[model samples]
Target: MWKYLKIVLALCGFILNTMILHTNPINDVTNLISIIEKLRPLHKKLGKPGPHDWLAHHHEPGQTFQEYYKSNPMTPRGKRCVIYIQPLGEFTQVQRRIVVLTSDFMSRFYNLQVKVQKDIPLSVIPNKARRRHPEWGVEQILTSYILNDILKPKLPADAAAYIALTISDLWPGRGWNFVFGQASLRERVGVWSIYRNGNPAESENSFRLCLLRTIKTAVHEIGHMFSMSHCVKYECCMCGSNHREEADRRPLWFCPECMAKVCWATCSDPVDRYQILAEFCEEHGFNNEKEFYKKSIAKLES
Candidate 1:
Protein backbone atom coordinates (compact mmCIF):
# COMPACT_ATOMS: atom_id res chain seq x y z
CA MET A 1 0.00 0.00 0.00
CA TRP A 2 2.76 2.41 0.89
CA LYS A 3 4.81 1.77 -2.26
CA TYR A 4 1.90 2.81 -4.52
CA LEU A 5 2.18 6.42 -3.51
CA LYS A 6 5.49 6.70 -5.35
CA ILE A 7 3.82 6.26 -8.73
CA VAL A 8 0.88 8.61 -8.06
CA LEU A 9 3.19 11.31 -6.78
CA ALA A 10 5.69 10.88 -9.60
CA LEU A 11 2.86 11.14 -12.08
CA CYS A 12 0.75 14.04 -10.77
CA GLY A 13 3.72 15.22 -8.68
CA PHE A 14 1.53 15.14 -5.51
CA ILE A 15 -0.19 12.59 -3.28
CA LEU A 16 -2.09 13.01 -0.03
CA ASN A 17 -4.73 10.99 1.85
CA THR A 18 -7.92 12.97 2.36
CA MET A 19 -10.56 11.92 4.89
CA ILE A 20 -12.31 8.60 4.36
CA LEU A 21 -16.00 8.11 5.24
CA HIS A 22 -17.46 4.87 6.46
CA THR A 23 -21.11 4.13 5.59
CA ASN A 24 -23.37 2.84 8.30
CA PRO A 25 -26.80 1.32 7.55
CA ILE A 26 -28.19 3.28 4.57
CA ASN A 27 -31.31 5.15 5.62
CA ASP A 28 -32.18 7.89 3.11
CA VAL A 29 -30.98 7.20 -0.44
CA THR A 30 -33.63 9.64 -1.62
CA ASN A 31 -31.77 12.41 0.16
CA LEU A 32 -28.64 11.71 -1.87
CA ILE A 33 -30.27 11.88 -5.33
CA SER A 34 -31.78 15.23 -4.43
CA ILE A 35 -28.37 16.73 -3.74
CA ILE A 36 -26.87 15.59 -7.06
CA GLU A 37 -29.73 17.17 -9.01
CA LYS A 38 -29.16 20.52 -7.33
CA LEU A 39 -25.59 20.73 -8.67
CA ARG A 40 -26.53 20.74 -12.35
CA PRO A 41 -26.59 23.89 -14.52
CA LEU A 42 -29.86 24.98 -16.07
CA HIS A 43 -30.23 22.57 -18.99
CA LYS A 44 -30.52 25.37 -21.54
CA LYS A 45 -27.79 27.45 -19.96
CA LEU A 46 -24.98 25.10 -21.06
CA GLY A 47 -22.80 26.25 -23.93
CA LYS A 48 -23.23 24.63 -27.31
CA PRO A 49 -20.42 22.39 -28.57
CA GLY A 50 -18.69 22.67 -31.92
CA PRO A 51 -18.33 19.64 -34.19
CA HIS A 52 -14.59 19.89 -33.65
CA ASP A 53 -14.95 19.40 -29.91
CA TRP A 54 -13.25 16.26 -28.59
CA LEU A 55 -15.44 13.64 -26.97
CA ALA A 56 -13.13 13.21 -23.94
CA HIS A 57 -9.48 12.76 -22.91
CA HIS A 58 -7.21 9.96 -21.50
CA HIS A 59 -3.41 9.98 -21.26
CA GLU A 60 -1.92 6.56 -21.95
CA PRO A 61 0.17 5.42 -18.98
CA GLY A 62 3.34 3.30 -19.50
CA GLN A 63 3.01 4.07 -23.22
CA THR A 64 5.40 6.12 -25.33
CA PHE A 65 4.28 9.59 -26.45
CA GLN A 66 3.95 8.29 -30.01
CA GLU A 67 2.02 5.26 -28.77
CA TYR A 68 -0.21 7.55 -26.73
CA TYR A 69 -1.10 9.62 -29.78
CA LYS A 70 -1.71 6.50 -31.84
CA SER A 71 -4.45 5.18 -29.51
CA ASN A 72 -5.58 8.78 -28.84
CA PRO A 73 -5.22 11.08 -31.84
CA MET A 74 -2.98 14.10 -31.31
CA THR A 75 -5.40 16.41 -33.13
CA PRO A 76 -9.08 16.57 -34.01
CA ARG A 77 -8.11 13.47 -35.94
CA GLY A 78 -10.49 10.59 -35.17
CA LYS A 79 -14.20 10.17 -34.35
CA ARG A 80 -13.91 11.64 -30.86
CA CYS A 81 -10.15 11.99 -30.84
CA VAL A 82 -8.92 15.45 -29.87
CA ILE A 83 -5.43 15.75 -28.40
CA TYR A 84 -5.14 17.87 -25.25
CA ILE A 85 -1.85 19.40 -24.28
CA GLN A 86 -1.57 21.71 -21.25
CA PRO A 87 -4.25 24.10 -22.46
CA LEU A 88 -3.64 26.18 -19.36
CA GLY A 89 -1.48 23.77 -17.32
CA GLU A 90 0.43 20.54 -17.45
CA PHE A 91 -1.19 17.07 -17.13
CA THR A 92 0.94 13.98 -16.71
CA GLN A 93 0.15 10.93 -18.78
CA VAL A 94 -1.71 9.10 -15.99
CA GLN A 95 -3.53 12.17 -14.76
CA ARG A 96 -4.70 12.62 -18.32
CA ARG A 97 -6.31 9.18 -18.22
CA ILE A 98 -8.15 10.13 -15.00
CA VAL A 99 -9.79 13.07 -16.77
CA VAL A 100 -10.86 11.01 -19.76
CA LEU A 101 -12.22 8.17 -17.66
CA THR A 102 -14.14 10.41 -15.25
CA SER A 103 -15.57 12.49 -18.08
CA ASP A 104 -16.67 9.37 -19.95
CA PHE A 105 -18.47 7.98 -16.88
CA MET A 106 -20.47 11.19 -16.27
CA SER A 107 -21.17 11.73 -19.96
CA ARG A 108 -22.49 8.21 -20.24
CA PHE A 109 -24.52 7.85 -16.97
CA TYR A 110 -25.98 11.36 -17.28
CA ASN A 111 -26.50 11.09 -21.04
CA LEU A 112 -24.71 14.41 -21.29
CA GLN A 113 -24.09 15.83 -24.76
CA VAL A 114 -20.97 17.75 -23.89
CA LYS A 115 -17.65 17.06 -25.66
CA VAL A 116 -14.47 16.09 -23.77
CA GLN A 117 -11.56 18.06 -25.14
CA LYS A 118 -8.06 18.11 -23.58
CA ASP A 119 -4.69 19.90 -23.73
CA ILE A 120 -5.87 23.42 -24.45
CA PRO A 121 -2.44 24.99 -23.93
CA LEU A 122 -1.60 26.69 -20.65
CA SER A 123 -0.89 30.01 -22.37
CA VAL A 124 -4.38 30.39 -23.86
CA ILE A 125 -5.79 32.64 -21.12
CA PRO A 126 -2.64 34.71 -20.41
CA ASN A 127 -4.06 35.67 -17.01
CA LYS A 128 -1.63 36.07 -14.14
CA ALA A 129 -4.00 34.63 -11.53
CA ARG A 130 -4.52 31.51 -13.62
CA ARG A 131 -0.86 31.27 -14.46
CA ARG A 132 0.26 31.70 -10.85
CA HIS A 133 -2.38 30.33 -8.48
CA PRO A 134 -0.82 27.57 -6.35
CA GLU A 135 -4.01 25.68 -5.50
CA TRP A 136 -5.56 26.18 -8.96
CA GLY A 137 -3.91 25.92 -12.35
CA VAL A 138 -4.17 27.51 -15.79
CA GLU A 139 -6.50 24.77 -17.01
CA GLN A 140 -8.96 25.06 -14.12
CA ILE A 141 -11.54 27.91 -14.37
CA LEU A 142 -11.23 29.36 -10.82
CA THR A 143 -9.07 32.22 -12.05
CA SER A 144 -11.78 33.23 -14.48
CA TYR A 145 -14.35 33.12 -11.67
CA ILE A 146 -12.21 35.41 -9.57
CA LEU A 147 -12.23 37.98 -12.38
CA ASN A 148 -15.96 37.55 -13.01
CA ASP A 149 -17.08 37.31 -9.36
CA ILE A 150 -17.45 41.02 -8.60
CA LEU A 151 -19.55 41.65 -11.70
CA LYS A 152 -21.85 38.90 -10.41
CA PRO A 153 -22.42 37.58 -6.90
CA LYS A 154 -23.57 34.00 -7.62
CA LEU A 155 -20.94 33.58 -10.34
CA PRO A 156 -18.72 31.47 -8.07
CA ALA A 157 -21.50 29.02 -7.23
CA ASP A 158 -22.36 28.40 -10.84
CA ALA A 159 -18.72 28.16 -11.83
CA ALA A 160 -18.04 25.65 -9.04
CA ALA A 161 -21.05 23.62 -10.07
CA TYR A 162 -20.07 23.49 -13.75
CA ILE A 163 -16.61 22.14 -13.04
CA ALA A 164 -18.14 19.77 -10.55
CA LEU A 165 -20.54 18.57 -13.27
CA THR A 166 -17.78 17.37 -15.59
CA ILE A 167 -14.38 17.18 -13.94
CA SER A 168 -13.00 15.45 -10.84
CA ASP A 169 -12.83 17.01 -7.34
CA LEU A 170 -15.36 18.25 -4.77
CA TRP A 171 -14.31 21.97 -4.79
CA PRO A 172 -16.64 22.98 -1.91
CA GLY A 173 -15.01 26.33 -1.06
CA ARG A 174 -11.85 27.17 0.90
CA GLY A 175 -9.53 24.19 0.53
CA TRP A 176 -12.24 22.93 -1.77
CA ASN A 177 -10.69 20.32 -4.09
CA PHE A 178 -12.55 21.53 -7.23
CA VAL A 179 -12.21 24.80 -9.23
CA PHE A 180 -15.17 26.51 -10.93
CA GLY A 181 -16.24 29.26 -13.36
CA GLN A 182 -19.48 31.29 -13.50
CA ALA A 183 -21.32 33.31 -16.14
CA SER A 184 -24.49 35.45 -16.33
CA LEU A 185 -26.95 32.78 -15.26
CA ARG A 186 -24.86 29.62 -15.34
CA GLU A 187 -21.59 28.22 -13.97
CA ARG A 188 -18.67 26.12 -15.32
CA VAL A 189 -16.60 23.47 -13.49
CA GLY A 190 -12.98 22.37 -13.91
CA VAL A 191 -10.28 20.43 -11.96
CA TRP A 192 -6.92 21.75 -10.82
CA SER A 193 -4.32 19.55 -8.99
CA ILE A 194 -0.78 20.61 -8.25
CA TYR A 195 2.01 18.04 -8.55
CA ARG A 196 4.65 18.46 -5.89
CA ASN A 197 5.35 14.99 -4.38
CA GLY A 198 4.35 11.89 -6.39
CA ASN A 199 1.32 9.83 -7.52
CA PRO A 200 -0.21 6.35 -7.09
CA ALA A 201 0.80 3.63 -9.52
CA GLU A 202 -0.18 0.36 -7.96
CA SER A 203 -3.12 -0.44 -5.67
CA GLU A 204 -5.99 -0.68 -8.13
CA ASN A 205 -8.29 -0.05 -5.17
CA SER A 206 -6.83 3.40 -4.82
CA PHE A 207 -7.29 4.18 -8.48
CA ARG A 208 -10.87 2.93 -8.34
CA LEU A 209 -11.51 5.17 -5.36
CA CYS A 210 -10.31 8.15 -7.33
CA LEU A 211 -12.53 7.20 -10.26
CA LEU A 212 -15.56 6.59 -8.05
CA ARG A 213 -15.07 9.92 -6.32
CA THR A 214 -14.92 11.57 -9.71
CA ILE A 215 -18.40 10.28 -10.42
CA LYS A 216 -19.56 11.47 -7.00
CA THR A 217 -18.10 14.90 -7.64
CA ALA A 218 -20.03 15.10 -10.88
CA VAL A 219 -23.26 14.01 -9.22
CA HIS A 220 -22.70 16.12 -6.12
CA GLU A 221 -22.05 19.30 -8.10
CA ILE A 222 -24.95 18.52 -10.42
CA GLY A 223 -27.10 18.37 -7.30
CA HIS A 224 -26.42 22.04 -6.78
CA MET A 225 -27.90 22.83 -10.18
CA PHE A 226 -31.25 21.23 -9.34
CA SER A 227 -31.81 23.47 -6.28
CA MET A 228 -30.90 20.83 -3.64
CA SER A 229 -28.38 21.47 -0.89
CA HIS A 230 -26.02 19.03 0.84
CA CYS A 231 -27.66 15.98 2.40
CA VAL A 232 -27.35 15.75 6.16
CA LYS A 233 -28.02 12.03 5.86
CA TYR A 234 -24.92 10.78 7.67
CA GLU A 235 -22.01 11.92 5.49
CA CYS A 236 -23.68 11.38 2.11
CA CYS A 237 -22.58 12.99 -1.21
CA MET A 238 -24.65 16.18 -0.85
CA CYS A 239 -23.41 16.96 2.63
CA GLY A 240 -21.86 20.19 1.28
CA SER A 241 -18.13 20.77 1.16
CA ASN A 242 -16.12 23.34 3.05
CA HIS A 243 -12.84 21.68 2.05
CA ARG A 244 -11.29 18.59 0.44
CA GLU A 245 -10.81 16.84 3.78
CA GLU A 246 -14.57 16.83 4.40
CA ALA A 247 -15.31 15.92 0.83
CA ASP A 248 -13.14 12.80 1.02
CA ARG A 249 -14.69 11.79 4.31
CA ARG A 250 -18.07 11.67 2.50
CA PRO A 251 -19.60 8.30 1.68
CA LEU A 252 -20.43 7.92 -2.03
CA TRP A 253 -23.83 6.35 -1.36
CA PHE A 254 -27.36 7.75 -1.60
CA CYS A 255 -30.07 7.37 1.03
CA PRO A 256 -33.68 6.46 0.15
CA GLU A 257 -34.74 10.06 0.33
CA CYS A 258 -32.07 11.22 -2.11
CA MET A 259 -32.65 8.26 -4.41
CA ALA A 260 -36.17 9.46 -5.02
CA LYS A 261 -34.86 12.69 -6.48
CA VAL A 262 -32.09 11.09 -8.62
CA CYS A 263 -34.71 8.94 -10.34
CA TRP A 264 -36.68 12.04 -11.24
CA ALA A 265 -33.65 13.86 -12.63
CA THR A 266 -32.42 10.97 -14.78
CA CYS A 267 -35.97 9.79 -15.20
CA SER A 268 -35.41 6.35 -13.68
CA ASP A 269 -36.42 4.51 -10.51
CA PRO A 270 -34.01 4.15 -7.58
CA VAL A 271 -34.66 0.45 -7.14
CA ASP A 272 -33.96 -0.22 -10.81
CA ARG A 273 -30.91 2.03 -10.86
CA TYR A 274 -29.48 0.44 -7.69
CA GLN A 275 -29.77 -3.00 -9.22
CA ILE A 276 -27.89 -1.89 -12.29
CA LEU A 277 -25.50 0.22 -10.26
CA ALA A 278 -24.56 -2.76 -8.07
CA GLU A 279 -23.45 -4.76 -11.05
CA PHE A 280 -21.59 -1.76 -12.36
CA CYS A 281 -19.87 -1.37 -9.00
CA GLU A 282 -18.92 -5.02 -8.97
CA GLU A 283 -17.48 -4.77 -12.46
CA HIS A 284 -15.51 -1.73 -11.26
CA GLY A 285 -14.77 -3.04 -7.72
CA PHE A 286 -16.70 -0.46 -5.68
CA ASN A 287 -17.83 -2.19 -2.48
CA ASN A 288 -19.25 0.96 -0.95
CA GLU A 289 -21.60 1.34 -3.90
CA LYS A 290 -22.94 -2.10 -3.24
CA GLU A 291 -22.81 -1.86 0.55
CA PHE A 292 -24.64 1.43 0.93
CA TYR A 293 -27.21 0.44 -1.68
CA LYS A 294 -28.29 -2.39 0.58
CA LYS A 295 -29.44 0.26 3.02
CA SER A 296 -32.04 1.40 0.49
CA ILE A 297 -33.62 -2.02 0.24
CA ALA A 298 -36.38 -3.37 2.48
CA LYS A 299 -34.71 -6.38 4.06
CA LEU A 300 -36.75 -9.46 4.89
CA GLU A 301 -35.97 -10.40 8.47
CA SER A 302 -34.70 -13.89 9.02
Candidate 2:
Protein backbone atom coordinates (compact mmCIF):
# COMPACT_ATOMS: atom_id res chain seq x y z
CA MET A 1 0.00 0.00 0.00
CA TRP A 2 2.87 2.39 0.79
CA LYS A 3 4.61 1.67 -2.55
CA TYR A 4 1.37 2.14 -4.55
CA LEU A 5 0.61 5.42 -2.79
CA LYS A 6 4.12 6.81 -3.47
CA ILE A 7 3.86 5.96 -7.20
CA VAL A 8 0.44 7.70 -7.41
CA LEU A 9 1.92 10.89 -5.81
CA ALA A 10 4.87 10.85 -8.24
CA LEU A 11 2.56 10.49 -11.23
CA CYS A 12 0.37 13.35 -10.02
CA GLY A 13 3.41 15.61 -9.72
CA PHE A 14 4.56 14.76 -13.23
CA ILE A 15 1.12 15.52 -14.68
CA LEU A 16 0.95 18.84 -12.88
CA ASN A 17 4.42 19.83 -14.11
CA THR A 18 3.56 18.90 -17.68
CA MET A 19 0.38 20.95 -17.56
CA ILE A 20 2.29 23.99 -16.24
CA LEU A 21 4.90 23.78 -18.98
CA HIS A 22 2.25 23.82 -21.68
CA THR A 23 0.12 26.44 -19.94
CA ASN A 24 2.81 29.14 -19.84
CA PRO A 25 3.46 29.25 -23.59
CA ILE A 26 -0.27 29.32 -24.32
CA ASN A 27 -0.64 32.23 -21.89
CA ASP A 28 2.21 34.07 -23.62
CA VAL A 29 0.62 33.67 -27.05
CA THR A 30 -2.77 34.69 -25.75
CA ASN A 31 -1.33 37.85 -24.23
CA LEU A 32 0.45 38.74 -27.46
CA ILE A 33 -2.75 38.22 -29.44
CA SER A 34 -4.58 40.55 -27.07
CA ILE A 35 -1.94 43.22 -27.46
CA ILE A 36 -2.13 42.96 -31.23
CA GLU A 37 -5.88 43.52 -31.15
CA LYS A 38 -5.62 46.51 -28.81
CA LEU A 39 -3.14 48.26 -31.07
CA ARG A 40 -4.92 47.49 -34.33
CA PRO A 41 -7.03 50.63 -34.44
CA LEU A 42 -3.96 52.84 -34.13
CA HIS A 43 -2.43 51.57 -37.37
CA LYS A 44 -3.32 52.65 -40.90
CA LYS A 45 -3.92 50.00 -43.54
CA LEU A 46 -1.69 50.27 -46.60
CA GLY A 47 -3.29 52.55 -49.17
CA LYS A 48 -3.31 52.24 -52.91
CA PRO A 49 0.26 52.32 -54.16
CA GLY A 50 1.51 55.05 -56.41
CA PRO A 51 3.21 54.25 -59.70
CA HIS A 52 6.68 53.92 -58.20
CA ASP A 53 5.69 52.49 -54.83
CA TRP A 54 7.29 49.27 -53.59
CA LEU A 55 4.01 47.38 -53.45
CA ALA A 56 3.21 48.47 -56.96
CA HIS A 57 6.16 46.45 -58.17
CA HIS A 58 6.74 43.79 -55.53
CA HIS A 59 3.25 42.26 -55.07
CA GLU A 60 4.12 40.36 -51.91
CA PRO A 61 1.51 38.77 -49.67
CA GLY A 62 2.21 40.33 -46.29
CA GLN A 63 2.53 38.22 -43.16
CA THR A 64 0.12 38.64 -40.30
CA PHE A 65 1.17 38.26 -36.66
CA GLN A 66 -0.48 34.83 -36.53
CA GLU A 67 1.29 33.72 -39.70
CA TYR A 68 4.64 35.02 -38.52
CA TYR A 69 4.34 33.26 -35.17
CA LYS A 70 3.42 30.01 -36.92
CA SER A 71 6.35 30.17 -39.37
CA ASN A 72 9.05 29.48 -36.76
CA PRO A 73 10.86 32.66 -37.67
CA MET A 74 14.53 33.09 -36.72
CA THR A 75 14.97 34.73 -33.38
CA PRO A 76 17.85 35.58 -31.09
CA ARG A 77 18.57 32.73 -28.70
CA GLY A 78 20.93 31.75 -25.90
CA LYS A 79 24.45 33.12 -26.41
CA ARG A 80 23.80 34.34 -29.97
CA CYS A 81 21.89 37.50 -29.06
CA VAL A 82 23.96 40.59 -29.73
CA ILE A 83 23.53 42.68 -32.89
CA TYR A 84 26.91 44.01 -34.10
CA ILE A 85 27.28 47.07 -36.32
CA GLN A 86 30.51 47.22 -38.31
CA PRO A 87 31.41 50.66 -39.64
CA LEU A 88 32.72 50.10 -43.14
CA GLY A 89 34.27 53.46 -44.04
CA GLU A 90 34.97 57.05 -43.04
CA PHE A 91 32.17 59.17 -41.62
CA THR A 92 31.95 62.87 -40.96
CA GLN A 93 31.46 64.09 -37.40
CA VAL A 94 27.77 64.48 -38.01
CA GLN A 95 27.54 61.05 -39.65
CA ARG A 96 29.38 59.47 -36.72
CA ARG A 97 26.93 61.12 -34.34
CA ILE A 98 24.07 59.75 -36.40
CA VAL A 99 25.62 56.27 -36.20
CA VAL A 100 25.78 56.45 -32.39
CA LEU A 101 22.19 57.64 -32.07
CA THR A 102 21.01 55.00 -34.54
CA SER A 103 22.73 52.29 -32.52
CA ASP A 104 20.97 53.46 -29.38
CA PHE A 105 17.60 53.42 -31.14
CA MET A 106 18.28 49.91 -32.48
CA SER A 107 19.06 48.61 -28.99
CA ARG A 108 15.81 50.04 -27.71
CA PHE A 109 13.91 48.81 -30.76
CA TYR A 110 15.04 45.18 -30.53
CA ASN A 111 15.72 44.87 -26.80
CA LEU A 112 19.15 43.57 -27.75
CA GLN A 113 22.66 44.73 -27.02
CA VAL A 114 24.10 46.57 -30.02
CA LYS A 115 27.85 47.20 -30.24
CA VAL A 116 29.43 49.32 -32.96
CA GLN A 117 32.63 47.68 -34.08
CA LYS A 118 35.64 49.73 -35.11
CA ASP A 119 35.72 51.34 -38.52
CA ILE A 120 36.81 49.37 -41.59
CA PRO A 121 38.30 51.26 -44.53
CA LEU A 122 36.53 51.36 -47.90
CA SER A 123 39.73 50.09 -49.54
CA VAL A 124 38.80 46.58 -48.42
CA ILE A 125 36.37 46.50 -51.36
CA PRO A 126 38.19 45.27 -54.46
CA ASN A 127 38.49 47.38 -57.64
CA LYS A 128 36.29 45.00 -59.60
CA ALA A 129 33.49 45.57 -57.11
CA ARG A 130 33.87 49.37 -57.23
CA ARG A 131 32.20 51.35 -59.99
CA ARG A 132 31.37 54.88 -61.03
CA HIS A 133 27.70 55.09 -61.99
CA PRO A 134 27.49 55.65 -65.74
CA GLU A 135 24.56 58.09 -65.69
CA TRP A 136 24.72 59.48 -62.15
CA GLY A 137 28.54 59.70 -61.68
CA VAL A 138 28.33 58.58 -58.04
CA GLU A 139 30.96 56.12 -56.79
CA GLN A 140 29.45 52.90 -55.42
CA ILE A 141 30.72 49.70 -53.82
CA LEU A 142 29.29 46.26 -54.50
CA THR A 143 27.02 45.16 -51.64
CA SER A 144 27.60 41.42 -52.30
CA TYR A 145 31.33 41.80 -51.59
CA ILE A 146 30.65 43.41 -48.25
CA LEU A 147 28.15 40.73 -47.16
CA ASN A 148 29.98 37.70 -48.60
CA ASP A 149 33.65 38.60 -48.14
CA ILE A 150 33.76 41.18 -45.35
CA LEU A 151 30.86 40.80 -42.90
CA LYS A 152 30.38 37.03 -43.23
CA PRO A 153 34.08 36.32 -42.62
CA LYS A 154 34.09 38.54 -39.55
CA LEU A 155 30.67 37.44 -38.26
CA PRO A 156 30.92 36.82 -34.53
CA ALA A 157 29.74 33.47 -33.23
CA ASP A 158 27.56 35.19 -30.66
CA ALA A 159 26.09 37.68 -33.13
CA ALA A 160 22.38 37.50 -33.80
CA ALA A 161 22.95 39.74 -36.80
CA TYR A 162 26.10 41.32 -38.24
CA ILE A 163 25.55 44.52 -40.28
CA ALA A 164 27.90 46.97 -41.95
CA LEU A 165 27.10 50.69 -41.92
CA THR A 166 28.79 52.85 -44.51
CA ILE A 167 28.70 56.45 -45.70
CA SER A 168 29.63 55.30 -49.19
CA ASP A 169 26.94 54.43 -51.69
CA LEU A 170 25.99 50.76 -52.37
CA TRP A 171 25.05 48.86 -55.53
CA PRO A 172 24.06 45.20 -55.70
CA GLY A 173 25.45 44.65 -59.21
CA ARG A 174 25.00 45.60 -62.88
CA GLY A 175 21.79 47.28 -64.11
CA TRP A 176 21.05 48.76 -60.71
CA ASN A 177 21.54 52.44 -59.97
CA PHE A 178 21.91 52.03 -56.18
CA VAL A 179 20.55 50.14 -53.23
CA PHE A 180 19.88 51.71 -49.86
CA GLY A 181 20.66 48.41 -48.16
CA GLN A 182 20.85 44.62 -48.57
CA ALA A 183 20.82 41.61 -46.23
CA SER A 184 20.93 37.79 -46.00
CA LEU A 185 18.07 36.78 -43.71
CA ARG A 186 19.02 33.19 -42.93
CA GLU A 187 22.73 33.97 -42.58
CA ARG A 188 22.06 37.02 -40.34
CA VAL A 189 24.22 39.52 -42.23
CA GLY A 190 23.42 42.88 -43.93
CA VAL A 191 24.89 46.14 -45.27
CA TRP A 192 23.36 49.62 -45.64
CA SER A 193 24.50 53.00 -46.92
CA ILE A 194 23.68 56.49 -45.68
CA TYR A 195 24.92 58.04 -48.88
CA ARG A 196 21.45 59.09 -49.97
CA ASN A 197 20.07 59.76 -46.51
CA GLY A 198 21.12 63.39 -46.96
CA ASN A 199 23.97 65.57 -45.68
CA PRO A 200 23.58 65.91 -41.94
CA ALA A 201 25.89 68.89 -41.68
CA GLU A 202 23.64 71.07 -43.81
CA SER A 203 21.19 72.17 -41.10
CA GLU A 204 19.32 71.05 -38.00
CA ASN A 205 16.36 69.74 -39.97
CA SER A 206 18.69 67.99 -42.38
CA PHE A 207 20.46 66.33 -39.48
CA ARG A 208 17.13 65.14 -38.06
CA LEU A 209 16.04 63.82 -41.44
CA CYS A 210 19.34 62.03 -41.94
CA LEU A 211 19.15 60.47 -38.49
CA LEU A 212 15.57 59.29 -39.08
CA ARG A 213 16.49 57.75 -42.42
CA THR A 214 19.48 55.95 -40.94
CA ILE A 215 17.45 54.54 -38.07
CA LYS A 216 14.78 53.35 -40.50
CA THR A 217 17.28 51.55 -42.70
CA ALA A 218 19.05 49.92 -39.77
CA VAL A 219 15.88 48.63 -38.11
CA HIS A 220 14.33 47.56 -41.40
CA GLU A 221 17.34 45.50 -42.44
CA ILE A 222 17.62 44.02 -38.98
CA GLY A 223 13.90 43.17 -39.18
CA HIS A 224 14.67 41.13 -42.29
CA MET A 225 17.48 39.41 -40.43
CA PHE A 226 14.86 38.27 -37.94
CA SER A 227 12.87 36.66 -40.79
CA MET A 228 10.26 39.44 -41.02
CA SER A 229 8.96 39.99 -44.52
CA HIS A 230 8.16 43.38 -46.06
CA CYS A 231 5.02 44.69 -44.45
CA VAL A 232 2.33 45.08 -47.10
CA LYS A 233 -0.61 45.48 -44.78
CA TYR A 234 0.28 48.78 -43.13
CA GLU A 235 2.36 51.95 -43.15
CA CYS A 236 5.20 50.33 -41.25
CA CYS A 237 8.97 50.46 -40.92
CA MET A 238 9.12 46.91 -42.21
CA CYS A 239 7.47 47.94 -45.47
CA GLY A 240 9.80 47.96 -48.45
CA SER A 241 10.51 51.21 -50.29
CA ASN A 242 11.51 51.51 -53.91
CA HIS A 243 12.54 55.15 -53.79
CA ARG A 244 13.49 57.92 -51.40
CA GLU A 245 9.98 59.39 -51.56
CA GLU A 246 8.38 56.11 -50.49
CA ALA A 247 10.96 55.60 -47.74
CA ASP A 248 10.54 59.10 -46.37
CA ARG A 249 6.81 58.55 -46.17
CA ARG A 250 7.16 55.48 -43.94
CA PRO A 251 6.87 55.98 -40.18
CA LEU A 252 9.78 55.15 -37.91
CA TRP A 253 7.66 52.75 -35.85
CA PHE A 254 6.35 49.32 -36.77
CA CYS A 255 2.65 48.75 -37.36
CA PRO A 256 0.50 46.66 -35.02
CA GLU A 257 1.23 43.31 -36.62
CA CYS A 258 4.92 44.00 -37.07
CA MET A 259 5.12 45.39 -33.55
CA ALA A 260 3.71 42.11 -32.26
CA LYS A 261 6.36 40.25 -34.21
CA VAL A 262 9.13 42.39 -32.71
CA CYS A 263 7.88 41.90 -29.17
CA TRP A 264 7.48 38.16 -29.72
CA ALA A 265 10.85 37.71 -31.42
CA THR A 266 12.72 39.56 -28.71
CA CYS A 267 10.60 38.27 -25.84
CA SER A 268 9.96 41.88 -24.89
CA ASP A 269 7.12 43.37 -22.93
CA PRO A 270 5.02 45.56 -25.18
CA VAL A 271 4.52 48.34 -22.65
CA ASP A 272 8.18 48.57 -21.70
CA ARG A 273 9.31 48.58 -25.33
CA TYR A 274 6.88 51.38 -26.20
CA GLN A 275 7.93 53.45 -23.20
CA ILE A 276 11.60 53.21 -24.13
CA LEU A 277 10.94 54.02 -27.78
CA ALA A 278 8.80 57.01 -26.78
CA GLU A 279 11.62 58.31 -24.62
CA PHE A 280 14.12 57.86 -27.41
CA CYS A 281 11.91 59.67 -29.89
CA GLU A 282 11.33 62.52 -27.45
CA GLU A 283 15.06 62.97 -26.90
CA HIS A 284 15.68 63.06 -30.63
CA GLY A 285 12.92 65.65 -31.31
CA PHE A 286 10.76 63.15 -33.18
CA ASN A 287 7.66 64.69 -31.66
CA ASN A 288 5.20 62.93 -33.92
CA GLU A 289 6.79 59.53 -33.45
CA LYS A 290 6.99 60.09 -29.71
CA GLU A 291 3.26 60.71 -29.53
CA PHE A 292 2.57 57.52 -31.49
CA TYR A 293 4.66 55.43 -29.11
CA LYS A 294 3.01 57.04 -26.12
CA LYS A 295 -0.39 56.14 -27.53
CA SER A 296 0.78 52.53 -27.97
CA ILE A 297 1.89 52.41 -24.33
CA ALA A 298 -1.45 53.78 -23.16
CA LYS A 299 -3.34 51.27 -25.24
CA LEU A 300 -1.31 48.34 -23.94
CA GLU A 301 -1.51 49.47 -20.32
CA SER A 302 -5.24 50.12 -20.48
| Per-model root-mean-square deviation over C-alphas | 20.0, 6.8
Q: Report the CA-based lDDT of candidate 1 relative to the real structure.
A: 0.39
Alpha-carbon runs more than 4 Å astray in model 1 = 1-90, 107-115, 131-202, 294-302
lDDT of 2 by residue, 1-302 (tens): 99999989878876775455334443277788888899999999989999988888788999988898788777776456899999988888889999999999999999999999999998888899899999889899999999999998898988989999998999999767888899886889999999999999999999999999999999999999898999998899999998999999999999988988888788777888889999999998999999999998888778
- Name the 10 consecutive residues with the lowest summed lDDT in model 2: 18-27
Q: Can you give the TM-score per candidate against the true fold?
A: 0.50, 0.90
* The best candidate in terms of TM-score: 2
Q: Compared with the true structure, what per-residue lDDT tens digits does model 1 show for residues 1-302? A: 66798766654431121111111112133444343344222111212222321111212122222222223211111121111111234655655666666555554333233344444444443344332335554233343433243223322221222331222222223443444221221233333332211243456666676666555665555544433444543345655444445456556654333444444334344455556566566667777667655444323111
lDDT of 1 at 59: 20
- Residue-pair clashes per candidate: 65, 0
How high is the lDDT of residue 256 in model 2?
A: 83
lDDT of 1 at 120: 42
